[model samples]
Structures are given as structure tokens and as C-alpha cells.
Target: MAEKITIFAHVRNICKASIFRICPPCLAALSRILARFHSNTQRQLVLFLNTAHFLTIGVSLALVVAFFLYAVDGRPIKGEDSFASEESEEFLPNVREIVGEIRPGDSLSSSFRSNGVDEEVRESVISAFDGVMNFREMKPNDRYTLTLDNDGTLIKCLYESGPLEVHAIERTPEGSLAAKKLDVALDCRTVKLRGRIESSLFAALAAFKEDAKLVYTFADIFASKIDFNTETRFGDTFELVVEKYYKNNEFVGYGKILVARYNSKEVGPLEGFYFDQGGKSAYFDHRGYELGESFIRSPVPMARVSSGFSYNRRHPVLDIVRPHLGVDLAAPMGTPIMATSDGRVRFAGWKGGYGKQIILDHGGGYQTYYGHLSRFAN
Candidate 1:
């Protein structure tokens, strides 16, 4: 009953809600129309709508739809229910709005239950927004609003997660809930994050509470030129410009890192800028060279390189001089192994001296070989 206009849930919220009275004779005729309109509906509360029409382009006639009735909130004539003798609430419709932020570790079902939303209504809302969004995927502080009638009939449900995940459910003409994914109007602003590396990049960004993914991405921009572990000095600093998304003045999340710069005392300063070349997206150095080197420096961090790549090397088990093609990294016995980059597994199993090995083909004729006593993902 919030937006009792020609459209369901939307247009009337923008326009002002005004009340005007109709004559007794006109109301009697209007009640008959309402009776026919709600023959199948069983709700005792009756709500009447008001619609206004405007002129179209290139039309001279000024036509106005005048019903002299803003909106009605009265008991239905044929319904077997009752209303209080006091008619003070008869003019205004009863609409209760529930708005809340989804806190961390809080389920939508639990939040709904806490907010006086019925269990049946919660189930129906979840069913309506199933494919549109899984409630489990909604991030902390994501918002939702529910509009219900006096008797707790759901009029509208709005769930907002991000720029692409705005969803709504509204009561249709037939009184069934219909769900739809809405296009969001987003504001993208360039943001800056700067930090001095006292130790690792992760430690530097810990104060800002930035995600590890962003740290990995920021380091990848300088992966080819600078080996962060070996080259980073005590006073090295970094800064970057990133895009942050917002909806209706509320922040959503981070977007692309547009520009990044790393200032090192040893390696000097280097800058990388994001660019869209042709249809592909990649980062470019300040002098217009593509910084497309995406190789992970070391599969195991803080692990010493026991053996470096060499043309001729001693075979440890065989006691002979041969070509050692791969660099061997040594860490603790239970140290977890991680893939250097994304790839499809070409082989996984025992491979002679390689033993319990997994070979990943990273396209472009580049393949990484992981060997020795360790388990790998399928």
C-alpha cells in the first residue's frame, strides 16, 4: 500500500503523496468498482490508487486525469472483517518499512526473523531472489529493505549487494510476488592507497585492512623487473590509483587498479599504468612498454632455493653430472605447495626421479614442473 499508483513499487515513491476526498455518491460508485476488482482478493484492508496522465510530445491538448481522490485506506465492503470506530487511520495507508545492514556472520534468514518478518515471508522472498542472488554470497554491510502492509502482506523487497546485484520483488497485479534484477546507477571514483614497506607488502597494507588479492595484484605489476623478495630494501614505498564503486553514497568495493608506482632505494622508482590495447587489457610501464610479465617469482615464499637452473649439475640420487633443468626449492616437510600461476594440469602422478609430480601448462609454450614428496590438487 506504500506506492498505490498505476505502477507497483516505484514511480509513486518519487511523487508526493497527497490526500483529497470524493463525494459520498462518487465513493459509493468507486466502492462497487473496488468490489469487482477485488472479488478474488480476500484482504479486509482496501487500498485505492490514483493515476495522473500527462501530455505527450507534439500534442497541444492539455489533458489531466482528475479523480479528486489521492489514495483510500478503508475496509472492504464485502469482506467479513471489522475496523475500529475511530476513522483517524482511514485516510493514510498502513505501510511498515524494514531496512537494515547485513552484518558479518549474520544470515539473511536470521536477520529477517529478528526484524519481525515472518518465516513464511522470508522463505517466499528467498525463493523469489534465488537465481538473482544466493543469500550466502551477499557481503557484510550489504543492504535490504522490505515494505509490508498492516497485516504483514509483503508489498516489496529490495536487496542491494553491489552495482550489478540489485534485485527487487514486488506484488504483481494478481497478488503474486515477482522478482527482477535491476540496473544499478553507480559512481566510480578513483582512489589512492599509499604505504611504506617496513617489511612485506602484506604487512604494509595490513593497517588499511586491504585484501590479500589486491596485494598480490599490486606486486604482479612489477613481477618481471623487480624480484620483491631479493630487491626490496628497508625504506621502499608504493602507491596506486584504484577505482571504487558506490551506490547512493554507500561504498561498494574496489575495482581496477588504474596506476601503480613502486619506489625502491635500490632499484629506483618504476611506474605501471593500466591500458586497454585493442581488446585485451594489460598494464604498461611509464615509457609505454607492456608490463605483461605475470609469472609468480617463487611458488614457496621464505623457502631457500637449494638448487638453481644450470646446464650441467650433479644428480643428487644418481651421483652423476647431468643437466639440472629445474630449480629446487627446500622448505619444511609439511609446507603447503601452491601453483605459480593458473594453468591446466597435463600430468599428475609419479614421474621417475620427479616423484609425486604435477606438470602445469601455462600456455605460450611455458610449463612449470613441481616435483618431490608432496600432494597436489586434481
Candidate 2:
């Protein structure tokens, strides 16, 4: 019995020494292997692996197994280096962008709602534009764009009201909404146009793609001398230097007529230059003479003369010989009548033969009369 006890004690001491020496390297390697596993189930799987096979496999092979297990679990490993990465993945939300146009009978609320925006976000957007813009003034074909987060929060919005005006609203860094009005700049370039009167002045201008406003301006500049309704003849030519506005190389509209020249058959040639003096702008001839006249030739534009001035004429209805002093102009009923010259109203009421008449008294011997059956201008 004494000999058996000594042999057992020696074997136990040898086993303890072997375990102490092997644990250090094996524990270090196990910690690295376990470092790749995040969940408890994966760590248990690693422990269940066959011991003989684990000893034969290299560290790279063990790492590959750990990666495969981590992928199947689909959970990120938590460590001191993962806080920033986790936060980055957590804060970014899904975003969506949409553009909407105002149609007939469509309001700002309807536009947002139709685009799948939440009701709460729509109301907040309306409140954001409260004092900045009047939704009632929104016109048809006006466009707007919206940017929203996954939670349906409005992050940014842009409203294009016109070619030159833009309204913008966005969430500020302080978590408050801010709105502003932006004006788009335009590039202005001067262009010269020359055309001859073929059928009519408006037709001639239209052939060259000139704006109708430009034609009206040309007639107004030469209204006193040339009667566009009757005096314009074939082959009469005109030239103009005007301003054209553009944005991003796209034409927008016209600005003003700088210089105008008209060669009329009746009135040889006329040239007008625009000048600003003492905050007042006026058209002048080459000799510095004002082109404006004391009175306009015709009060109504494009009206035909029904009867001319005659010393002795027979009345159509009464069939009596009488003297018609003023010329009679025939026009549509309810058509507006303008004063031939700038003068105060002397009389505006009903007369015997004339239904509704307005008589103006120019200071001198010159006096004009307008007779019609319509309402008077205020």
C-alpha cells in the first residue's frame, strides 16, 4: 500500500505541471477565437467543436469559421471601436424627394397631400410659409419640391413662383424652420430688329417673332404723326433697338425700346431718341424737339369713321339738313372712350340726341366732344 500511494502522487504532480504550462498559450488563442463571436450561441458552438480537429486547424482556419458564424447570426460584434460605427448606422434615415405643380383648383395643402406627404408635415410646411408667402397668390403651373426623412419630417422645400422669384424653406441647425425669398438674376442683351410693313404693321412684326408689346410701343412712339390705322402703307419700314432678358441662356422677355426709327411715305423720315432728364424720361427728335403732341389724333384705336365732318348734311333718322361739326366714329357698344387730350371733364350726362355725352373744354378755342350710349369713365 505505501508503494502504490507514492506512484499515484508522482503521476498527479506531473499532470498539474503539464496543465499549467499548456493553459497560457491555449487561453490566449481561445480569447482571440472568442473575440470574433458576439452572441452566446456562437461561443457555445465553438466549444462544441471536436477537440482533435480544433488542435489540427490553423489560426486562420479558426478565424474563417468565426466569420461564417458571425455572418449567419447577422449581429455586429460589440467592442470599444464599434460605438461610432453603430451610431453612424443608427442616425441616417431614409429620404425621399418629390416635385409638384399647382393645377387648377389646387392649393398648397392639396399639392403636398397628393404627393403622399403626411398631413402633419403639410401643416407644418404651411405654417413655415405663413408670413413669408400668401398661398392665395399661388398661380397655376407654379412648381415646388419637397425633401422628407423616413419619419415624414420635412427637411427642405423650394417654391418657384416665377422666372425670377424663388421661395425657400429649410430646417436649420438649431432645429427651427427658416424661410427666405430669393431673386434670380437675369442677363440682359440689346438686340436690333428691322422689318418692312407687308400687309400690316402687326403682321410685319409677327413675321420677325417680335413681341406684340413691341409693336404697340412702336405705334405709341409715333402715334401723333403716323396714324397706324390709316396712314401705314406698304413698304414703310421701321427699325428698333430693344433689350432682351435671358436666364441660363434661355430667353425670358423684353425690356425697353432704346431707339426707334420710322420711314413713312407721308412724313418722309422720323427718328426718336430716349432721354432721362431730372428723373423724367421722354422721347425727343434728333433736334431735341419733344415728340409728344398736344392732342392725340384718334381717341379710340382701330375705330372706323362712320361719318366725316360736313358743313351741310342730312340727318339719317330725322332726315333734316344740318351741320355735323364733329366726326362720328362707329365702334362696338360699351367700348371705352378716351380723351383726345389731357383735360378735365366739363360735362358728363345725357343729351337730347346723344344718349350719353362727355364734353371736354380745352383752355383755348379748342374743344372736343364725345357722344355715345355707354357709361362714362371716372
Best candidate, lDDT: 2
lDDT of 2 by residue, 224-295 (tens): 676676777889999989899999998887787889998988777988888888998888888988886667
Worst 10 residues of 1 by lDDT: 62-71
The C-alpha local distance difference test score for the whole of candidate 2 amounts to 0.77
Tens-digit per-residue lDDT, 1-378, candidate 1 = 332332322223312233334455655554454445453341232332333312221132322222112123443433333343345458677899999788878888888888878888899998888887776678888899999888888899999885678889999999999999888788999879998988777788777887766776677777666766567778899999988788788777778999999998887998999998789998888788888456767665545578888988988899899998887888778666667778999989999978999899999998988899577653
Q: What is the lDDT of residue 125 in candidate 2?
A: 83
Cα-based lDDT at residue 41, candidate 2: 47
Candidate 2 residue runs with Cα over 4 Å from true position: 1-86, 93-95, 107-137, 170-180, 277-279, 296-378
Task: Tell me each candidate's TM-score.
Answer: 0.51, 0.56
lDDT of each: 0.74, 0.77
Error of 1 at 269 (Å): 4.6
Best by TM-score: 2
Provide the RMSD of all predictions against the true structure, rounded to 1 decimal.
22.2, 11.9
